[model samples]
Target: MDAVAARSGVHRTTVYRRWGDVGGLLADVLDAASDDDWQPPDTGSLEGDLAALNQEIQTAMAAQPPIMAALIAASFRSEKAADAQQRLWEDRYARCEIVVSRAVRRGDIPPRTDARRLLIAATAPLYHQLVLLRTPHDPQLPGHAARTAVLAAAAGAFAEPEPPSADDT
Candidate 1:
Protein backbone atom coordinates (compact mmCIF):
# COMPACT_ATOMS: atom_id res chain seq x y z
CA MET A 1 0.00 0.00 0.00
CA ASP A 2 2.79 2.34 0.84
CA ALA A 3 4.58 1.63 -2.42
CA VAL A 4 1.43 1.95 -4.44
CA ALA A 5 0.35 5.06 -2.61
CA ALA A 6 3.77 6.51 -3.12
CA ARG A 7 3.71 5.70 -6.81
CA SER A 8 0.18 6.97 -7.35
CA GLY A 9 0.62 9.96 -5.06
CA VAL A 10 -2.46 9.00 -3.11
CA HIS A 11 -2.63 8.81 0.65
CA ARG A 12 -2.25 5.29 2.08
CA THR A 13 -5.52 5.88 3.87
CA THR A 14 -7.27 6.67 0.61
CA VAL A 15 -5.91 3.53 -1.01
CA TYR A 16 -6.88 1.45 1.99
CA ARG A 17 -10.37 2.93 1.98
CA ARG A 18 -10.89 1.93 -1.63
CA TRP A 19 -9.13 -1.44 -1.61
CA GLY A 20 -9.46 -2.74 1.94
CA ASP A 21 -5.82 -3.10 2.98
CA VAL A 22 -2.78 -4.19 1.00
CA GLY A 23 -3.65 -7.84 0.47
CA GLY A 24 -6.98 -7.03 -1.15
CA LEU A 25 -5.31 -4.47 -3.34
CA LEU A 26 -2.59 -6.92 -4.34
CA ALA A 27 -5.12 -9.67 -4.94
CA ASP A 28 -7.10 -7.46 -7.26
CA VAL A 29 -3.99 -6.58 -9.20
CA LEU A 30 -2.80 -10.20 -9.34
CA ASP A 31 -6.21 -11.43 -10.43
CA ALA A 32 -6.32 -8.89 -13.22
CA ALA A 33 -2.82 -9.75 -14.38
CA SER A 34 -3.46 -13.48 -14.35
CA ASP A 35 -6.81 -13.25 -16.08
CA ASP A 36 -6.59 -10.84 -18.94
CA ASP A 37 -9.34 -12.12 -21.21
CA TRP A 38 -8.04 -15.69 -21.25
CA GLN A 39 -10.60 -18.21 -22.42
CA PRO A 40 -10.00 -21.93 -22.87
CA PRO A 41 -10.27 -23.48 -26.30
CA ASP A 42 -12.53 -26.47 -26.74
CA THR A 43 -11.21 -28.54 -29.62
CA GLY A 44 -13.30 -31.62 -28.93
CA SER A 45 -10.43 -33.69 -27.56
CA LEU A 46 -8.34 -33.70 -24.41
CA GLU A 47 -5.12 -33.45 -26.37
CA GLY A 48 -6.27 -30.41 -28.23
CA ASP A 49 -7.94 -28.95 -25.19
CA LEU A 50 -4.76 -29.22 -23.13
CA ALA A 51 -2.63 -27.91 -25.93
CA ALA A 52 -4.84 -24.89 -26.23
CA LEU A 53 -4.81 -24.49 -22.49
CA ASN A 54 -1.02 -24.57 -22.46
CA GLN A 55 -0.89 -21.93 -25.14
CA GLU A 56 -3.26 -19.72 -23.21
CA ILE A 57 -0.99 -19.85 -20.16
CA GLN A 58 2.14 -19.25 -22.18
CA THR A 59 0.56 -16.27 -23.81
CA ALA A 60 -0.54 -14.78 -20.53
CA MET A 61 2.81 -15.32 -18.84
CA ALA A 62 4.64 -13.93 -21.79
CA ALA A 63 2.55 -10.82 -21.74
CA GLN A 64 2.91 -10.21 -18.02
CA PRO A 65 6.28 -11.36 -16.74
CA PRO A 66 6.20 -8.61 -14.16
CA ILE A 67 3.29 -10.22 -12.43
CA MET A 68 5.27 -13.43 -12.12
CA ALA A 69 8.28 -11.56 -10.84
CA ALA A 70 6.25 -9.76 -8.21
CA LEU A 71 4.58 -12.92 -7.03
CA ILE A 72 7.85 -14.84 -6.96
CA ALA A 73 9.57 -12.09 -5.03
CA ALA A 74 6.78 -11.74 -2.52
CA SER A 75 6.52 -15.50 -2.13
CA PHE A 76 9.90 -15.43 -0.46
CA ARG A 77 8.69 -13.72 2.71
CA SER A 78 4.96 -13.13 2.95
CA GLU A 79 1.71 -15.01 3.33
CA LYS A 80 0.18 -12.42 1.06
CA ALA A 81 2.17 -13.92 -1.80
CA ALA A 82 0.73 -17.34 -1.13
CA ASP A 83 -2.77 -15.90 -0.94
CA ALA A 84 -2.19 -13.94 -4.10
CA GLN A 85 -0.84 -17.05 -5.82
CA GLN A 86 -3.86 -19.10 -4.77
CA ARG A 87 -6.24 -16.47 -6.06
CA LEU A 88 -4.25 -16.18 -9.23
CA TRP A 89 -4.41 -19.94 -9.72
CA GLU A 90 -8.15 -20.00 -9.09
CA ASP A 91 -8.79 -17.20 -11.53
CA ARG A 92 -6.52 -18.59 -14.21
CA TYR A 93 -7.29 -22.27 -13.71
CA ALA A 94 -11.05 -21.83 -13.33
CA ARG A 95 -11.42 -20.97 -16.99
CA CYS A 96 -9.53 -24.06 -18.04
CA GLU A 97 -11.37 -26.14 -15.46
CA ILE A 98 -14.68 -25.13 -16.99
CA VAL A 99 -13.46 -26.29 -20.37
CA VAL A 100 -12.04 -29.55 -18.99
CA SER A 101 -15.27 -30.17 -17.12
CA ARG A 102 -17.09 -29.81 -20.38
CA ALA A 103 -14.94 -32.65 -21.67
CA VAL A 104 -15.71 -34.69 -18.57
CA ARG A 105 -19.42 -34.05 -18.98
CA ARG A 106 -19.22 -34.97 -22.62
CA GLY A 107 -17.56 -38.28 -21.70
CA ASP A 108 -14.27 -37.34 -23.26
CA ILE A 109 -12.70 -37.61 -19.81
CA PRO A 110 -13.43 -39.95 -16.96
CA PRO A 111 -16.23 -38.69 -14.76
CA ARG A 112 -14.20 -39.13 -11.57
CA THR A 113 -10.97 -37.68 -12.89
CA ASP A 114 -9.22 -34.80 -11.18
CA ALA A 115 -9.43 -31.84 -13.51
CA ARG A 116 -7.46 -29.49 -11.29
CA ARG A 117 -4.48 -31.79 -11.09
CA LEU A 118 -4.65 -32.43 -14.79
CA LEU A 119 -4.53 -28.71 -15.46
CA ILE A 120 -1.69 -28.15 -13.05
CA ALA A 121 0.36 -30.98 -14.50
CA ALA A 122 -0.36 -30.03 -18.07
CA THR A 123 0.00 -26.32 -17.53
CA ALA A 124 2.21 -25.37 -14.63
CA PRO A 125 5.54 -27.06 -15.33
CA LEU A 126 6.16 -25.42 -18.62
CA TYR A 127 4.99 -21.95 -17.71
CA HIS A 128 6.79 -21.89 -14.40
CA GLN A 129 9.93 -23.58 -15.66
CA LEU A 130 10.21 -21.09 -18.43
CA VAL A 131 9.25 -17.87 -16.73
CA LEU A 132 10.39 -18.64 -13.22
CA LEU A 133 13.55 -20.61 -13.81
CA ARG A 134 16.94 -19.59 -15.14
CA THR A 135 18.41 -20.49 -18.57
CA PRO A 136 18.77 -24.01 -19.83
CA HIS A 137 15.19 -23.11 -19.19
CA ASP A 138 15.93 -22.52 -22.85
CA PRO A 139 12.50 -21.00 -23.44
CA GLN A 140 12.36 -23.48 -26.32
CA LEU A 141 12.37 -26.35 -23.86
CA PRO A 142 8.86 -25.69 -22.57
CA GLY A 143 7.18 -24.80 -25.88
CA HIS A 144 8.11 -28.08 -27.47
CA ALA A 145 7.49 -30.21 -24.41
CA ALA A 146 4.36 -28.29 -23.46
CA ARG A 147 2.52 -29.36 -26.60
CA THR A 148 3.41 -33.00 -26.18
CA ALA A 149 4.93 -34.19 -22.92
CA VAL A 150 3.18 -31.82 -20.57
CA LEU A 151 -0.22 -31.98 -22.22
CA ALA A 152 0.02 -35.72 -22.60
CA ALA A 153 0.82 -36.15 -18.93
CA ALA A 154 -2.21 -34.07 -18.09
CA ALA A 155 -4.52 -36.03 -20.40
CA GLY A 156 -3.25 -39.45 -19.50
CA ALA A 157 -3.07 -38.84 -15.76
CA PHE A 158 -6.61 -37.54 -15.51
CA ALA A 159 -8.07 -39.77 -18.20
CA GLU A 160 -9.37 -43.03 -16.88
CA PRO A 161 -9.61 -45.65 -19.61
CA GLU A 162 -12.55 -47.31 -17.90
CA PRO A 163 -12.98 -49.46 -14.85
CA PRO A 164 -12.86 -53.24 -14.97
CA SER A 165 -16.29 -54.73 -14.54
CA ALA A 166 -17.11 -56.64 -11.35
CA ASP A 167 -18.32 -59.28 -13.77
CA ASP A 168 -15.10 -59.41 -15.79
CA THR A 169 -14.90 -62.72 -17.60
Candidate 2:
Protein backbone atom coordinates (compact mmCIF):
# COMPACT_ATOMS: atom_id res chain seq x y z
CA MET A 1 0.00 0.00 0.00
CA ASP A 2 2.72 2.39 0.92
CA ALA A 3 4.65 1.55 -2.20
CA VAL A 4 1.54 1.97 -4.33
CA ALA A 5 0.73 5.30 -2.78
CA ALA A 6 4.30 6.46 -3.17
CA ARG A 7 4.43 5.32 -6.76
CA SER A 8 1.12 6.92 -7.61
CA GLY A 9 1.90 10.16 -5.75
CA VAL A 10 -1.12 9.62 -3.50
CA HIS A 11 -1.07 9.84 0.26
CA ARG A 12 -0.79 6.57 2.18
CA THR A 13 -3.93 7.28 4.21
CA THR A 14 -5.89 8.13 1.07
CA VAL A 15 -4.80 5.01 -0.73
CA TYR A 16 -5.56 2.87 2.30
CA ARG A 17 -8.97 4.45 2.70
CA ARG A 18 -9.78 3.93 -0.99
CA TRP A 19 -8.63 0.35 -1.46
CA GLY A 20 -8.77 -0.92 2.16
CA ASP A 21 -5.95 -3.46 1.63
CA VAL A 22 -3.82 -5.30 -0.86
CA GLY A 23 -6.60 -7.74 -1.65
CA GLY A 24 -9.04 -4.98 -2.39
CA LEU A 25 -6.47 -3.17 -4.50
CA LEU A 26 -5.72 -6.28 -6.45
CA ALA A 27 -9.42 -6.99 -6.91
CA ASP A 28 -10.01 -3.50 -8.26
CA VAL A 29 -7.08 -3.85 -10.59
CA LEU A 30 -8.41 -7.13 -11.95
CA ASP A 31 -11.93 -5.82 -12.23
CA ALA A 32 -10.70 -2.81 -14.14
CA ALA A 33 -8.83 -5.08 -16.50
CA SER A 34 -11.96 -7.14 -17.07
CA ASP A 35 -13.88 -4.03 -18.01
CA ASP A 36 -11.77 -3.57 -21.10
CA ASP A 37 -13.26 -4.32 -24.53
CA TRP A 38 -10.82 -6.97 -25.66
CA GLN A 39 -11.84 -9.25 -28.49
CA PRO A 40 -10.07 -12.18 -30.12
CA PRO A 41 -8.63 -11.81 -33.59
CA ASP A 42 -10.70 -12.88 -36.60
CA THR A 43 -8.28 -14.03 -39.28
CA GLY A 44 -10.96 -15.75 -41.42
CA SER A 45 -9.60 -19.21 -40.55
CA LEU A 46 -9.59 -21.08 -37.24
CA GLU A 47 -5.88 -21.84 -37.36
CA GLY A 48 -4.99 -18.25 -38.15
CA ASP A 49 -7.24 -16.89 -35.43
CA LEU A 50 -5.96 -19.33 -32.83
CA ALA A 51 -2.37 -18.63 -33.78
CA ALA A 52 -2.93 -14.90 -33.51
CA LEU A 53 -4.53 -15.24 -30.10
CA ASN A 54 -1.72 -17.50 -28.89
CA GLN A 55 0.85 -14.99 -30.10
CA GLU A 56 -0.87 -12.28 -28.09
CA ILE A 57 -0.86 -14.47 -25.00
CA GLN A 58 2.81 -15.27 -25.49
CA THR A 59 3.69 -11.62 -25.81
CA ALA A 60 1.79 -10.69 -22.66
CA MET A 61 3.22 -13.57 -20.66
CA ALA A 62 6.74 -12.81 -21.81
CA ALA A 63 6.59 -9.13 -20.93
CA GLN A 64 9.36 -7.84 -18.67
CA PRO A 65 8.40 -7.43 -14.96
CA PRO A 66 5.72 -10.13 -15.50
CA ILE A 67 2.64 -8.32 -14.17
CA MET A 68 0.22 -11.04 -15.30
CA ALA A 69 2.23 -13.73 -13.46
CA ALA A 70 2.35 -11.63 -10.29
CA LEU A 71 -1.39 -10.99 -10.45
CA ILE A 72 -2.13 -14.71 -10.90
CA ALA A 73 0.13 -15.60 -7.94
CA ALA A 74 -1.39 -12.90 -5.71
CA SER A 75 -4.90 -14.11 -6.57
CA PHE A 76 -4.14 -17.38 -4.75
CA ARG A 77 -3.56 -15.50 -1.50
CA SER A 78 -6.57 -13.18 -1.70
CA GLU A 79 -10.18 -14.23 -1.95
CA LYS A 80 -11.23 -10.88 -3.39
CA ALA A 81 -8.46 -11.03 -5.95
CA ALA A 82 -9.28 -14.62 -6.77
CA ASP A 83 -12.93 -13.78 -7.38
CA ALA A 84 -11.99 -10.81 -9.49
CA GLN A 85 -9.55 -12.91 -11.46
CA GLN A 86 -12.23 -15.49 -12.06
CA ARG A 87 -14.54 -12.81 -13.39
CA LEU A 88 -11.79 -11.53 -15.61
CA TRP A 89 -11.17 -15.00 -17.00
CA GLU A 90 -14.88 -15.55 -17.57
CA ASP A 91 -15.17 -12.28 -19.41
CA ARG A 92 -12.21 -13.08 -21.60
CA TYR A 93 -13.49 -16.57 -22.36
CA ALA A 94 -16.92 -15.26 -23.24
CA ARG A 95 -15.41 -12.76 -25.61
CA CYS A 96 -13.19 -15.36 -27.20
CA GLU A 97 -16.08 -17.78 -27.74
CA ILE A 98 -16.92 -15.83 -30.87
CA VAL A 99 -13.80 -17.29 -32.43
CA VAL A 100 -15.08 -20.82 -31.96
CA SER A 101 -18.55 -19.84 -33.14
CA ARG A 102 -17.07 -18.41 -36.30
CA ALA A 103 -15.07 -21.57 -36.89
CA VAL A 104 -18.17 -23.70 -36.56
CA ARG A 105 -20.05 -21.42 -38.91
CA ARG A 106 -17.24 -21.72 -41.43
CA GLY A 107 -17.26 -25.52 -41.15
CA ASP A 108 -13.77 -25.60 -39.69
CA ILE A 109 -14.78 -27.45 -36.54
CA PRO A 110 -17.65 -29.55 -35.20
CA PRO A 111 -20.88 -27.82 -34.25
CA ARG A 112 -20.71 -28.83 -30.57
CA THR A 113 -17.06 -27.93 -30.09
CA ASP A 114 -16.26 -26.73 -26.62
CA ALA A 115 -14.82 -23.28 -27.13
CA ARG A 116 -13.22 -22.97 -23.70
CA ARG A 117 -11.48 -26.30 -23.94
CA LEU A 118 -10.23 -25.59 -27.44
CA LEU A 119 -8.95 -22.16 -26.41
CA ILE A 120 -7.21 -23.49 -23.33
CA ALA A 121 -5.54 -26.20 -25.31
CA ALA A 122 -4.36 -23.67 -27.85
CA THR A 123 -2.88 -21.33 -25.22
CA ALA A 124 -1.86 -23.59 -22.34
CA PRO A 125 1.58 -24.37 -23.71
CA LEU A 126 2.62 -20.75 -23.43
CA TYR A 127 1.48 -20.58 -19.81
CA HIS A 128 3.14 -23.87 -18.97
CA GLN A 129 6.45 -22.80 -20.44
CA LEU A 130 6.57 -19.16 -19.34
CA VAL A 131 4.70 -19.30 -16.04
CA LEU A 132 4.96 -22.84 -14.69
CA LEU A 133 8.28 -24.22 -15.83
CA ARG A 134 9.76 -20.74 -16.39
CA THR A 135 11.45 -21.93 -19.55
CA PRO A 136 13.06 -19.57 -21.96
CA HIS A 137 10.72 -18.24 -24.62
CA ASP A 138 10.56 -20.25 -27.83
CA PRO A 139 9.67 -18.19 -30.89
CA GLN A 140 7.88 -21.07 -32.59
CA LEU A 141 5.79 -22.07 -29.57
CA PRO A 142 2.69 -19.97 -30.22
CA GLY A 143 2.08 -21.07 -33.80
CA HIS A 144 3.00 -24.70 -33.03
CA ALA A 145 0.60 -24.95 -30.12
CA ALA A 146 -2.12 -23.21 -32.09
CA ARG A 147 -1.67 -25.59 -35.03
CA THR A 148 -1.76 -28.61 -32.74
CA ALA A 149 -4.95 -27.43 -31.05
CA VAL A 150 -6.60 -26.64 -34.38
CA LEU A 151 -5.87 -30.17 -35.57
CA ALA A 152 -7.23 -31.68 -32.38
CA ALA A 153 -10.32 -29.50 -32.37
CA ALA A 154 -11.03 -30.24 -36.02
CA ALA A 155 -10.80 -33.95 -35.17
CA GLY A 156 -13.59 -33.56 -32.58
CA ALA A 157 -11.27 -33.66 -29.55
CA PHE A 158 -13.13 -30.79 -27.92
CA ALA A 159 -16.61 -31.66 -29.10
CA GLU A 160 -19.27 -31.90 -26.41
CA PRO A 161 -20.40 -35.42 -25.63
CA GLU A 162 -23.79 -36.33 -27.03
CA PRO A 163 -26.68 -37.12 -24.71
CA PRO A 164 -27.41 -40.82 -24.22
CA SER A 165 -30.19 -42.15 -26.42
CA ALA A 166 -33.45 -43.44 -24.90
CA ASP A 167 -32.61 -46.91 -26.17
CA ASP A 168 -29.46 -46.93 -24.00
CA THR A 169 -31.57 -46.39 -20.93
Candidate 3:
Protein backbone atom coordinates (compact mmCIF):
# COMPACT_ATOMS: atom_id res chain seq x y z
CA MET A 1 0.00 0.00 0.00
CA ASP A 2 2.76 2.40 0.91
CA ALA A 3 4.64 1.45 -2.22
CA VAL A 4 1.59 2.16 -4.34
CA ALA A 5 1.09 5.49 -2.66
CA ALA A 6 4.70 6.39 -3.14
CA ARG A 7 4.71 5.43 -6.77
CA SER A 8 1.40 7.12 -7.59
CA GLY A 9 2.22 10.19 -5.52
CA VAL A 10 -0.99 9.85 -3.62
CA HIS A 11 -1.23 9.96 0.15
CA ARG A 12 -1.68 6.67 1.96
CA THR A 13 -4.70 8.00 3.80
CA THR A 14 -6.32 9.00 0.55
CA VAL A 15 -5.73 5.60 -0.95
CA TYR A 16 -7.09 3.88 2.13
CA ARG A 17 -10.13 6.09 2.25
CA ARG A 18 -10.86 5.53 -1.41
CA TRP A 19 -10.23 1.80 -1.82
CA GLY A 20 -10.53 0.52 1.78
CA ASP A 21 -8.17 -2.37 1.04
CA VAL A 22 -6.09 -4.16 -1.55
CA GLY A 23 -9.04 -6.23 -2.70
CA GLY A 24 -11.11 -3.17 -3.44
CA LEU A 25 -8.24 -1.66 -5.34
CA LEU A 26 -7.68 -4.88 -7.25
CA ALA A 27 -11.35 -5.10 -8.15
CA ASP A 28 -11.27 -1.58 -9.55
CA VAL A 29 -8.12 -2.23 -11.52
CA LEU A 30 -9.41 -5.50 -12.91
CA ASP A 31 -12.70 -3.92 -13.92
CA ALA A 32 -10.96 -1.03 -15.64
CA ALA A 33 -8.49 -3.30 -17.39
CA SER A 34 -11.27 -5.56 -18.61
CA ASP A 35 -13.04 -2.78 -20.46
CA ASP A 36 -12.62 -3.08 -24.20
CA ASP A 37 -14.69 -1.57 -26.96
CA TRP A 38 -13.46 -4.05 -29.53
CA GLN A 39 -16.05 -6.59 -30.55
CA PRO A 40 -15.46 -9.72 -32.59
CA PRO A 41 -15.02 -8.75 -36.19
CA ASP A 42 -17.59 -10.01 -38.64
CA THR A 43 -15.55 -12.18 -40.95
CA GLY A 44 -18.73 -13.21 -42.82
CA SER A 45 -18.87 -16.63 -41.14
CA LEU A 46 -18.92 -18.07 -37.63
CA GLU A 47 -15.80 -20.11 -38.30
CA GLY A 48 -13.98 -17.08 -39.64
CA ASP A 49 -14.98 -14.94 -36.72
CA LEU A 50 -13.92 -17.64 -34.24
CA ALA A 51 -10.59 -18.00 -36.00
CA ALA A 52 -10.03 -14.28 -35.76
CA LEU A 53 -10.91 -14.32 -32.08
CA ASN A 54 -8.61 -17.25 -31.48
CA GLN A 55 -5.75 -15.46 -33.15
CA GLU A 56 -6.37 -12.39 -31.03
CA ILE A 57 -6.41 -14.46 -27.86
CA GLN A 58 -3.23 -16.19 -28.82
CA THR A 59 -1.50 -12.92 -29.54
CA ALA A 60 -2.62 -11.41 -26.28
CA MET A 61 -1.67 -14.50 -24.27
CA ALA A 62 1.73 -14.50 -25.88
CA ALA A 63 2.30 -10.95 -24.76
CA GLN A 64 1.26 -11.42 -21.14
CA PRO A 65 3.99 -10.89 -18.57
CA PRO A 66 5.17 -13.65 -16.24
CA ILE A 67 3.40 -12.01 -13.33
CA MET A 68 0.05 -12.80 -14.87
CA ALA A 69 0.70 -16.49 -14.34
CA ALA A 70 1.24 -15.94 -10.67
CA LEU A 71 -1.76 -13.67 -10.40
CA ILE A 72 -3.98 -16.23 -12.07
CA ALA A 73 -2.75 -18.94 -9.75
CA ALA A 74 -3.29 -16.76 -6.71
CA SER A 75 -6.81 -15.87 -7.72
CA PHE A 76 -7.89 -19.43 -7.08
CA ARG A 77 -6.99 -19.18 -3.40
CA SER A 78 -7.83 -15.57 -2.65
CA GLU A 79 -11.42 -14.47 -2.21
CA LYS A 80 -10.99 -10.90 -3.40
CA ALA A 81 -8.86 -11.89 -6.35
CA ALA A 82 -11.29 -14.68 -7.16
CA ASP A 83 -14.20 -12.27 -7.24
CA ALA A 84 -12.35 -9.90 -9.54
CA GLN A 85 -11.23 -12.74 -11.73
CA GLN A 86 -14.76 -14.07 -11.96
CA ARG A 87 -16.02 -10.66 -13.00
CA LEU A 88 -13.34 -10.38 -15.64
CA TRP A 89 -14.26 -13.74 -17.07
CA GLU A 90 -17.96 -12.96 -16.94
CA ASP A 91 -17.29 -9.87 -19.02
CA ARG A 92 -15.23 -11.86 -21.49
CA TYR A 93 -17.88 -14.57 -21.87
CA ALA A 94 -20.58 -11.95 -22.33
CA ARG A 95 -18.56 -10.41 -25.12
CA CYS A 96 -18.12 -13.77 -26.78
CA GLU A 97 -21.89 -14.18 -26.85
CA ILE A 98 -22.06 -11.64 -29.63
CA VAL A 99 -20.14 -13.97 -31.88
CA VAL A 100 -22.43 -16.90 -31.13
CA SER A 101 -25.53 -14.73 -31.55
CA ARG A 102 -24.24 -13.54 -34.88
CA ALA A 103 -23.66 -17.13 -35.93
CA VAL A 104 -27.23 -18.00 -35.00
CA ARG A 105 -28.53 -15.11 -37.07
CA ARG A 106 -26.42 -16.34 -39.99
CA GLY A 107 -27.77 -19.86 -39.55
CA ASP A 108 -24.30 -21.15 -38.88
CA ILE A 109 -25.17 -22.42 -35.42
CA PRO A 110 -28.34 -23.48 -33.64
CA PRO A 111 -30.15 -20.75 -31.75
CA ARG A 112 -29.95 -22.82 -28.56
CA THR A 113 -26.17 -22.98 -28.58
CA ASP A 114 -24.76 -22.00 -25.19
CA ALA A 115 -22.35 -19.24 -26.06
CA ARG A 116 -20.72 -19.06 -22.65
CA ARG A 117 -20.05 -22.77 -22.46
CA LEU A 118 -18.70 -22.84 -25.98
CA LEU A 119 -16.38 -19.95 -25.29
CA ILE A 120 -15.14 -21.53 -22.07
CA ALA A 121 -14.61 -24.87 -23.76
CA ALA A 122 -12.70 -23.09 -26.49
CA THR A 123 -10.30 -21.29 -24.16
CA ALA A 124 -10.02 -23.52 -21.07
CA PRO A 125 -7.41 -25.81 -22.54
CA LEU A 126 -5.21 -22.94 -23.52
CA TYR A 127 -5.45 -21.45 -20.05
CA HIS A 128 -4.82 -24.80 -18.39
CA GLN A 129 -1.70 -25.39 -20.44
CA LEU A 130 -0.44 -21.89 -19.87
CA VAL A 131 -1.18 -21.39 -16.18
CA LEU A 132 -1.49 -24.83 -14.60
CA LEU A 133 1.10 -26.82 -16.48
CA ARG A 134 3.37 -23.85 -17.11
CA THR A 135 4.27 -25.58 -20.33
CA PRO A 136 5.79 -23.86 -23.29
CA HIS A 137 3.17 -22.01 -25.30
CA ASP A 138 1.86 -23.90 -28.30
CA PRO A 139 1.25 -21.60 -31.23
CA GLN A 140 -1.25 -23.99 -32.79
CA LEU A 141 -3.32 -24.52 -29.65
CA PRO A 142 -5.62 -21.56 -30.16
CA GLY A 143 -6.54 -22.60 -33.68
CA HIS A 144 -7.16 -26.13 -32.54
CA ALA A 145 -9.21 -24.94 -29.61
CA ALA A 146 -11.38 -22.79 -31.83
CA ARG A 147 -11.87 -25.61 -34.27
CA THR A 148 -12.79 -27.99 -31.46
CA ALA A 149 -15.29 -25.53 -30.09
CA VAL A 150 -16.89 -25.11 -33.52
CA LEU A 151 -17.12 -28.86 -33.92
CA ALA A 152 -18.55 -29.28 -30.45
CA ALA A 153 -21.17 -26.64 -31.00
CA ALA A 154 -22.10 -28.23 -34.33
CA ALA A 155 -22.43 -31.57 -32.55
CA GLY A 156 -24.81 -30.10 -29.96
CA ALA A 157 -22.21 -30.36 -27.18
CA PHE A 158 -23.01 -26.84 -26.16
CA ALA A 159 -26.72 -26.94 -26.81
CA GLU A 160 -29.06 -25.58 -24.16
CA PRO A 161 -30.70 -28.09 -21.89
CA GLU A 162 -34.14 -29.37 -22.78
CA PRO A 163 -36.98 -27.98 -20.74
CA PRO A 164 -38.45 -30.35 -18.17
CA SER A 165 -41.51 -32.33 -19.27
CA ALA A 166 -44.40 -33.47 -17.10
CA ASP A 167 -43.73 -37.15 -17.74
CA ASP A 168 -42.12 -37.86 -14.34
CA THR A 169 -43.30 -34.99 -12.14
| Pairs in steric clash, model 3 | none
lDDT of each: 0.65, 0.86, 0.75
lDDT of each residue in 28-76, candidate 3, tens digit only: 7677868867576578867777777777766666663533444466576
Backbone clashes counted, model 1: 0
Write one digit per residue (lDDT tens) for candidate 2, span 1-169: 6767987998999998998877798899888888777789999998999889888988887776666777788788889888888898888878999999999899999987888999889888988888889888788998999999999998999998985456842
Clashing pairs in 1: none
How does candidate 1 fare on TM-score?
0.60
lDDT for model 1 comes to 0.65
Once model 1 is optimally superposed onto the true structure by TM-score, how far is the C-alpha of residue 59 displaced, in angstroms?
A: 2.7
How big is the RMSD of model 3?
4.8
Summed backbone clashes in each candidate are: 0, 0, 0
| Runs off by more than 4 Å, candidate 2 | 1-3, 11-13, 163-169
Give per-residue CA lDDT, model 1, range 1-169, as digits (tens).
Answer: 6767878998999898998755567767876778688677778776677766666555545554345555555656656766887777787777677766676677765665666777777776765675667334244443454455434544566655676467842
Output the number of the TM-score-best candidate.
2
